[model samples]
Target: MYSISFLIGFSLLAGFAVAASPDVETRSRRVRLSASVIALASVLLALFHLASGPEFFALSPGVLHVLDWMFTIGGVGLALVLLYFCRRIVAREWYIPVLVVLQTGLMLSAEFAEVTPEVAHPFYIDSFTVLMTLIVGVVGGLICIHAIRYMQDYHAHEKTVPNRQAAFYFMLFLFLASMFGIVFSNHLLWLFFFWEVTTLCSFWLIAYSGTDEAVRNGFRALGLNLIGGVSFAAAIAWLTFGPGLHTWELDQLIAAGSAMALIPAVLIAVAGLAKSAQLPFSSWLLGAMVAPTPVSALLHSSTMVKAGVFLLVKLSPVFYDTYAGLLLSLIGGVTFLVTSLVAVNQRNAKLVLAYSTIANLGLIVMCAGVGTAGAMWAAILLILFHAVAKALMFLAVGTTEHLIGSRDIEDMEGLVYRRPAMAAMMLVGILGMFLAPFGMLLSKYTSFQAFLSMDVMLGDGLMLATILAFGSAPTLFFWSKWMGKLVAMPRRLPPGTDPIPRDEAIALVSLTLITYVACALFPLADKVFVIPYTDYLGALGLIPVVAASIPWDNIAIMSLMLAGLFLMPLAFWLRPPRHAEVSGYLSGANVSGSASYRGAMGVERVVESRGYYLSGFIREDIMMRYGMLGAGVLIVVMVGGVAL
Candidate 1:
């Protein structure tokens, strides 16, 4: 029967296939098809888990044995190679459906056949694991498809650079496979192996352009992540030798409580902080923007950084109400507040996105540090909404950059008139990040309630609330500025064809619908996914589950507003609503109509306004220096508190 092993193995094997392909066209077709299949498999896996009980396929004794046999002895080697042969059009067309049908049959059989009693092993599967798999498979797949068209344009623009599309796709698929491994592995050693694989993949993809700056940034990323790797290794060593625990299973270690696990947990938390690009470790992600847009989307949203938070949230229970928890939460709080302010100073489109990504990650880290069931619930919601929304924003910006020939926020001032479809999609992405009646906003509201309910001894709830309130202001400022630029109208539309390629358009539209659907169905999501997971934690005595319920009344209101948000836009676009056009009114007489005004010396002056970035006061370099300093201190205190 199909299992998580197949999901991991197929993705790993697909990376090898894509890398070994003879040409660019073959590589593209194989990657797109492979990603689609992986996504389908992920959805089926999640559904099967839901249909069966929570304990369904929780663990089995001989799971790895099956994986070993499938990958060896020339059993499926020949068929795997034939699957990617682009010249055989008929074979390619037939192979996909056949594969899908077989997988579906296998999954159905496994579901109906008697499930064995649950057992413990290196691998673990649960609702959370499947939820993450869905995010990676679905979001990661769309990003891959979008990259197909974006890379072609990228190569055209960077004519002097050597083509390395095959290597790029190889790294992309390998990254996906590594993510599956990270989420599924319960053995700390096994998890470490996958964690390092993602780090290596990240370095390779970031340096694909082979430029001096790209190489430099890639090395910087490698060095910092290696520090994280070393920390993970040290934690494993401590768990095995220091505490005298022979087993490396994470659940067993957490069940040992804070007294036995605090030191190793703090070490692992340091690794998570670095991997997620928290304040002191954030330079690597910012520099990663030198890579293509897909790389940024993949790293920032679904795959790499998400792996970091997944680990941290898993380890949250161990640190609850300890001094370590207070210090760690402070690290995240400081990172969030500082980065949001720094983002306001950035004019480069990607830089702004990168800073915002780090800031939101900081918020997730803060929730994890709180270590209550309710806080973890808020953390997971933030991850889900942020992944979909951020992916949409990054991909939309990439398409807009290609059309306008610049990534500066000022250059996109009249995008709505020039490319209405792209602008509308971009607007949707922007709204998802900060506005009411959207998942991100609602997630933040949940986090606020979770914070209020916390009963931690060492942590000050009011202080955390203050940081959140102050930090959110700058988030609104930066996103609103960019949103305004996208919608601002010019006197006349520019004379050019801002055509979105089919692949890019499909990804953008799909993500937009996903963002809306997720917001619309959030109350149901909370019941189905969040509540159950938290209840399980409470039952295990891992966290204190307080009295929490989804705010149904607020959800109903948001639904009504959401309906208007989408329906009004569709109505305006569908119907012909004619309006009278008017010229701009200047205080003085209009010299050349709305374009120019008369000055004191009878000189013609152009009318214009610009965004207030506060670049002089809120400098990026200055803020980063101080932010890193503050976060570094907090991390030190967390480790010390735990050890002492």
Candidate 2:
């Protein structure tokens, strides 16, 4: 079944990529068919995991050796190609590619010199891997479905760019395949190969428009991510070459618990931080807004960035409470606090999502560094809830932009009156992001508990908790502003129907419903998923995984909030105001019963309520430069901590 999952991913990927040059009808049929098969295969995969012997399978020794040679040579070639492009496009920033090439060479040398190691169970399964697969399979399939309608609108509006529909869908499927590989691979080299494939895929998708800005931003993503790839390769080299860690299997290495493993763990953590866009490295994601929104939904919410946090969380056992873990907490906490403050100063909707993504990821990383059962519990839930809410927001934003031709938060004013359905969807996403009775806030609350419970003797416990408190305040403010604008009423009604395409509607509703269902199932998920995972991984004494002690009153409070918050919009949409009536206090004669009123001179005047951006205190240039600088210095400290 595991092997079959790979086959399904690749088949769909190749089939979609090649179908690009075909007619639109042909491409649609093929994409829909492929999406079905991909989702079905994912379901089958979960079924397969239901009964297993914890088995590990690999090819014979001779075949394993051949595969090793193939991977090493192929990887080196790809690294060289990446370097060439990096230098060719941005000659002044030449050292980046050069550094990548050097790191690749060192990695290859170390790996090649090792005793021809057998690929021990090149693939395996665990509860965590299964969850990742479900995310990739389900969320990914929905995005593909949505993209069908989205690309049509995109091409209609964007005539200058070639209609590379086939190539675009192809990359999306290919990313899915790579994601499965990433979650399933037990071998180091195999994981890295899949990792770089995603990097290349992201570059292609980001640069799809072929605009100078698009191409330039794509390269920026490539260069930054390749640095991460280099770090991952270095980790593999150290694992293979360092003492008592000759194997590529993750379980084996963790079982060894060698102190020498700390450095390699740190290297992998660096790679994770970069992939997750934690601290100093979040610019690539913000720049990615230039691409289509489906791409943003995939990369930011479900698949790409999540890989980074997944790795860090998986490696929590290595550094928990140790110096390495404490250092990671510092990076995560600082990124969360800074990015949340920066998010408050954004007007662009996508940029807000981008910064919010970074901030949430930072919280996850901090939790992973805290390295307790409770923290891990919070981390997993955060990942799941975030994927649903963020994906919904991106798609809703994309639809809103198409409808109104803008992604500015201000332009969303009175959206509930204009595009009621889409506005309600956006509202649900917003509430899910910030308000109560939703998973994101629930996860953040859980994360706070995790941080507070961490041993304060480590010095990081109270510090991380403090950062989270400050970060969360700004998060509430920014989301509330957008939500307020979206729900604001306008006296003058625009005549139009909600113009959302059927496919797009399906995707949006799926994600929005997913948010609430996930919320309702939170307690059950904790017991069924979290406790079993903890038990399987051993007590580790990280935190109490006690499920029964959860507060029911809090759940009751959130349940009431969800019903009201999510349903109020539906009720409003069901019976949208027929008569444009008075909603506020104008206290005088008004021209249209709006914010404007006639003055003593009989001239009309308007009142404005512009949201705060904190421009003077937190300009983009100031925060980015400061964020990168401070993060860089602390990263050095983190690395040094690993060394000691």
Candidate 3:
């Protein structure tokens, strides 16, 4: 009966060992082995903590004080570390360290003013905590496992960045360890400590290549997230000093949700928005694309950005009807619409994934702002589905890029005949993202229902719904185009020579299976995990109990719809011998063996067409400009409203 906390420490130690040894294949094996151990502990952690309320740990109050001092020092240490990493800009940007020192000062002040709370528990392992732990352990671990193969292929061509294998694995594993700590910690300051650890790890990884763009974007990420750290520190100070409040434990805050109002709560929510990259702050995540693919996948899917939405979801109760809540909904709605439009205007596949991640997270933020049990329910499911599907898509793109030397969606044309296995896997990810029966679309449908259930055309819910409707059509357009290209190869073409690496193939195939399995059993998943977490929120008086009536007929129809979406293309895939081989329309005589046609002067020409990016009509630069200005106005309004 090992504690998951202990097991995570063990994995961290093992990661250090692997990093010291300096071998990629061995590191891969050890990482997966550590992941397996974590996966098992996750199950056991769930078994032990089920409905077991607040089990106190054996620790003296004196040790707690020492722990507080450690984190205060830790905050300063992180500032120094960031300053070192971003040293090149320090001469020009003296305010960077100045702000960091200010944040550290606030944390130190909060540390001393905060008496050791009456409640001394360091951790809580509720069902939601358990769910988060599993995601970090499983999805995060899979990405790490996938990173093994990816980094190897990555270094093959990535000569600009000197090989830093040891540093990469160490940061990645440490990030996982910190994620476990973040999920379980009950004390607000302790949570902030782990939260900052994630920010630091991300900065290092994003700048791993050390190129001019990489380093610049790394600073962008660091500066914005440190703003979140400052906001988080201020929230702690306000909670410790403002009013009659005495404790920094989140559960206690929720218990007194009725008493807590805008000032401190809004501080915490603003930090979440920054971390989640909502609206005006989204440029960091877009800039994060300069990092390696696993870094992008890790931050977007399982860990960093997810942390932001998690905090907002946790604080959804405090956000129920205030102007702060209305503003959050507005930011999310606008972000979703703007990013979805921006996604269509990009040919870069990873950029498409980046924009899509921001868009989906905006939806999650909307759900949390809606602050109903059903909305939270959809928010949680989106977290789960997006993590896996996005991971799969990222890895697929990474593999495809290495094999073909391109990340453009148009280059992925004829992928079905060229890399059928990979094409099928990518299809699963794309379909899961937008089509029926799969978890993301199902969760979206639930979110729409939640929005409609609210006061339509009269409230924030209606405004959000309008954004959702406009945003969704572009999603179908872009995804359908990619899907069409993946299978567009003539029936008789032979497969490509580049085999997907063994480890990457394993990770991809496993995730594909999980996606289908999760879809098939989503009902059971809802019954076991989703319903209980929402019920817990109800018990806390945070939200009302949603109607328990199961939508069996809708479920049946959705199932039929998924079957059609899944089966029809697969049927076409199976019809090779019986399928007629036809060339793409050329409007005249075509070359027999290639995609070329005869010119009027009898010179051969290669005909090609690319997806319409609508570069002129729907420009990214213009969208970002207006989107940021609008979001900036809303934020100013929020602060003004709070001040008044």
**Per-model tally of clashing residue pairs:** 0, 1, 0
* Colliding pairs, model 1: none
Q: In candidate 3, how many Å is residue 11 off?
A: 3.7
Cα RMSD, each candidate: 9.7, 2.8, 2.6
Question: Which regions of candidate 3 deviate over 4 angstroms?
Answer: 47-63, 90-93, 114-118, 436-438, 455-457, 490-495, 548-550, 567-585
In TM-score terms, candidate 2 sits at: 0.92
Evaluate all candidate structures by whole-model CA lDDT and list the values in order. 0.77, 0.77, 0.78
Error of 2 at 250 (Å): 1.6
Least accurate 10 contiguous residues by lDDT in model 3: 572-581
Segments in model 1 whose C-alpha atoms lie over 4 Å from true places: 52-120, 436-438, 566-582, 585-593, 596-604
Candidate 3: pairs in clash = none
Q: Candidate 1 — worst ten consecutive residues by lDDT sum?
A: 70-79
Residue 359 of candidate 1: its Cα lDDT?
94
Per-residue lDDT tens digits for candidate 3, residues 92-182, read: 5566666677778888887776363554676776666777777787777778777888888788889777888788888888888888878
What TM-score would each prediction reach against the true structure?
A: 0.87, 0.92, 0.94
| Stretch of 10 with least lDDT, candidate 2 | 540-549
Model 3 score (lDDT): 0.78
